[model samples]
Target: MHTPEHILIINVTRIGDTLAATPAINALHEHWPQARISVVGSPHHIEILQNLPGVVRVGALTKNSALFRGWLGAKHFDLAVVYNYDQALVRYALRVARHVVAFRQKSPAINRRLYRCVDPDAYPTVHITEHALKLPVALGIRGANGRILYRCTPDEVDRAKDRLVGRNFDGKRPLIGLQIDSFPTKSYRDWPVESFLALCRRMLARWPQAGFLIYGGPAEMPRTQWLKQQLGDSACLFAGLLSLRETAAQMALTDLYIGVDTGPTHLMSSFDIPIIGLYHPRHPARSLGPKDHPLNFSLDHPHDAAPSSEPQSMSDITVDRVFCQVEKALATRGIS
Candidate 1:
């Protein structure tokens, strides 16, 4: 009912969830072309939104605890879109924005004040981004596109290439990026490292010209390093090396991606590249696989009753099976 000239989006979740809000954000820009967007989020996670279409400014909330109230008292946002159900943020949106759009949280009493909100479970089968669009859709807004808003510049892509060249990567072949580990502690979302290494070997045997870029965070350096060591030659590690923007740029250069159900894997989805995400039975592929990208291929496998190891389902998922999926994805040129 009310159009917000200046909009504030408050998302303080982790990398993946933060990135998950892109499609809806893009749709918001499309629906409201004249609106200026400002976002508040975690330090590193908000980096991806740097060049996002019409985003005027990005503010970090982690480094400054008082930033929330600053956003509220200093600038009055016509509308606030809160992605997660943090009660504090909900309260802030209510105080600052004339209108608020968010997903329904547990405390209906608080959410009842918002201009619009959607039940997250209503579209359980849909991509998370699609669910996000439901918020704007609830506002009688339409034509909101469903693409991630990560914008990589030519310079950044070239920088990624330079980084690769530094690592002895030849520009002649189609690069295949691999992310072997999930979050350091949350290994349940990860497939086995050996499986990735084995998959790399098969990939090398098939496409010798294919290069590998190993991606992970500082916490995942140990596991990522081992995989890089085993992968060897055409392989390079991007763990503690690149900034978030640089990661997107490098991922844009990748021909294909094979990784577990992790944040980086989802972050890589921003680029229009083919990604193979290995999923465990505990968490079904349909549940957490690629959101809107057709190029993403998710392989779901069975697991033991009790969780013996993380990614328990990996034991049942054979390297050949994963390789077959990888080959199939490459065969498509990720056109879908």
Candidate 2:
């Protein structure tokens, strides 16, 4: 295929999945530097891709929006790459773009229509970012650099700093960020709240001046609030108060992050901060942990020792094991 003048990437999914696709989108841009890249994502997450390096446009799309999206429009795109197997999204791409690339759909008729129908299981299980990269790799685009892209403006960074200062986090050394729980549906991935409280006690004992920024959505506020109460003045709770972008900006100022496998953890990976990501056996570190990160200290459940079809407990990841990594991260940064 000739170099396409315009490319469209559709990824209408949750934050983690949306962020996972950025590496593939980066590859597409590297190969075709001049092509105008546009992305359609979930309304809640489309903002995450707004200021990415090569993306010229970022918009929201739902299954409903896909139904009538291209019916009234001309095929102005030369190529379209879609992630996931939503038939509505695939059908919309078919209506609007000359050539489309996606995973092989369940319907044989849909499979027959794709420019490249990638067998999702053809490749061995790998990192989620690499898994998403398979879409662009089908088009001979390579060298993605294996880094998730996120940008915060100078103003945003300044405001984040001011906010941290307002919360009295300015003079705190080894300021750590805590993600108390994963989203509701993936509750299995959450480490117990008591574990987080215990971990904070250990850190405070070591550094004495260590401060924590507890982050979460409204649903997890009870856990985050309890953690704040346990830590007293040493912690500030941003659970139900901050916007996604606001939380991200605040995260960028932290010295370290400790969290479960979730969307905010994925966002933290974009920064150069030290991270300790706790993972469950079903979706272990090997599949979802940060890639090409210099300071990643991700721990997988013991059940991950031998891949299993059965469920395991997040409590299996002990506080001491996590503290060991915390010590190592602090030592690396000369935090003593």
Candidate 3:
């Protein structure tokens, strides 16, 4: 196969899904060092792709925007790899690129048009990162690393530090970031608020100067506000105040991150900070936890051993189990 000058990678999904595709993107860059890699992702979460190594351009493309793309434009791309099964995106890639690689779509005709149509089910992998890597692997491109990539500008980093200083978190030891809930649709993944309160109480007891950075969207305000009220002066609420990019910048400053299996958790994994991610039974740590992270202490629900048709509660994971991992993470950093 000839080396391509320009490559377009499309993943119009949520933050976690978008981040899952980073390793694949990295593989493509490593294989063809001179390729100008352009990414199209979800509008709300596309900022996460900004400043990633080897990716020259990042943009948002929704199903609506994909409708009009490639109609008047020349076929400028040498190759395009799409992670989405959306026919519109694949068709757009087909129109604009000489060769296109994507998962087999529902339409046999569309699959025939792809330069390489990968069957997702054929490669049954335990982890989503590996599953996403299969797309690049189909082109004989091996992954450079398992870790997800993210970069915050120096200005953004400084602003985050300034915000922390304004909140008097300058000298606070172990500035822990908390992602209290998943999205509304996946509320079952959320650990009980009571559990978080218990964990915070334990953390405060251990490190009196420990501060909490509460992160969430507006939809999770009630839970985040309650946590803030419980933690009092020790917690700073950034739930509804900061933009996604701003949140990522602030996340880079944290000493530790303890969250559910959500987008921010995936984003936090990109950093070198210690993280304790709680997973539900359905989405076990093996499938969604941080990969190749030295400080990852992810816990899975007890019900993971016994899958049932009934909905499982995340509360099955006791506060004690999580605090034990917390102690281990802090001890590794010589904070204890």
Model 3 C-alpha lDDT per residue in residues 1-336, reported as the tens digit of each score: 479999999999989989999988888988989999999988998988988778999999998899898988689899999997899999999999999999989999999988999988532245888888888889987745778888889999999999999999877888899998999899999999999999999999999999999999999999999999999999999998998889989999888899998999999999898999999887888888999898998898988878788989999899999999999988877888
Candidate 1 has which clashing residue pairs, if any? none
lDDT of each: 0.77, 0.89, 0.90
Top candidate on TM-score is 3
Highest lDDT among the candidates is held by which one?
3
A best-first ranking of the candidates according to their TM-score comes to 3, 2, 1
For model 2, residues 231-282, the per-residue Cα lDDT tens digits are 9999989998988888899999888999999999999999988999999877
User: Model 1 segments beyond 4 Å from truth?
Assistant: 62-75, 106-109, 122-125, 142-145, 302-312, 333-336
TM-score of each: 0.88, 0.97, 0.97
Predictions: Cα RMSD each:
3.4, 1.5, 1.3
Residue 57, model 3: lDDT of: 95
What is the TM-score (0 to 1) of candidate 3?
0.97
In candidate 2, position 139 carries an lDDT of 92
